[model samples]
Target: MSNEQAWEAVVVSKSRAPLDGSNLYRRVTVRHDDGPEEKIRVAREAWKQIEVGDRVMKEAGQDPRRA
Candidate 1:
């Protein structure tokens, strides 16, 4: 995938769970502009940066961003 292309999506829901002992994993469900909803795993720090209803730019296998 091209790194320059970021898909636009809206944060729909978020959940957190323990991953690999002390590390925490955040899962977020996002609705994309093209009409599909996806569940993506993200860093806890990145998850903390977003909220439901927030619009973000999502790159494949990368953290979401607001722009």
Candidate 2:
């Protein structure tokens, strides 16, 4: 399948250095049709929040792949 057809997104919470030492950064990646995937990365304990948003959107019949 084409990238667009195989679209998927991931939200990640990962650690950084210095300012974040041992802390995690939350990130999300959403696929697009005519350009690079969209990515939003942030700090704080954001994994649950981000994932919940994703799930809500999905359950509401919104396809994250279509933008």
Candidate 3:
């Protein structure tokens, strides 16, 4: 596969789970080919910001924005 194809296949899995007797939490995994994966936990509010930022970035050709 080409570099771009490999890059596209880079696994970035996102999921969420509820905390016992508390609000739900989110987890994001960023993995590289044959390398260790990075996991992060974020609260709901922070997760919203992340989701919004991702959408805007994708729509704007992955450009950063001030909001």
Candidate 4:
């Protein structure tokens, strides 16, 4: 079995925070139908491509053995 997992979620909110001198990072909060809300950090450009109420698929986790 693979250690990776994916979920379908709805975007709840979005925020931005300073990364370095002038760079910024975006944080997106999403809620799953069967789970609590989760916050994910994404690139500013990628973040701009999504909006609240949008449905998105999120994936995480990796098997070290595959590395």
Clashes of each: 0, 0, 0, 0
Tens-digit lDDT string for candidate 1 (11-45)? 89989878678977788889988889988776667
lDDT of 4 by residue, 1-67 (tens): 1237756778889899776768777788888778788777766566878888887674567211100
User: What is every candidate's alpha-carbon RMSD to the true fold?
Assistant: 3.0, 9.3, 9.9, 7.0
- Which regions of candidate 2 fall more than 4 Å away from where they truly are? 1-19, 42-46, 49-67
Predicted candidate 2 versus true structure: per-residue lDDT over 3-67, tens digit per residue? 23334444322333344677554555543334455554443444334552242122233333211
Per-model TM-score versus the true fold = 0.72, 0.29, 0.40, 0.69
Give model 4 RMSD, 1 decimal. Answer: 7.0
What residue pairs clash in candidate 3, if any at all? none
lDDT of each: 0.79, 0.39, 0.43, 0.68
> Which residue pairs show backbone clashes in model 1?
none
Clashes of 3: 0
Off by over 4 Å in 1: 1-5, 19-22, 59-62
Q: Which stretch of 10 consecutive residues in model 1 shows the poorest summed lDDT? A: 58-67
Task: Using TM-score, give the best candidate's number.
Answer: 1
Summing lDDT over every window of 10 consecutive residues in candidate 2, give the lowest-scoring window.
55-64
Which candidate, 1 or 3, would have the higher lDDT against the true structure? Answer: 1
Residue 29 deviation, candidate 3, in Å? 0.8
**Candidate 3 ranges beyond 4 A from true positions:** 1-11, 32-34, 49-67
Candidate 2 residue 42 Cα shift, in angstroms, is 4.2
| lDDT by residue for model 3 (1-67), tens | 2212322112256678776658676765544345665555545664555542142111122322112
Q: Global lDDT for candidate 2?
A: 0.39
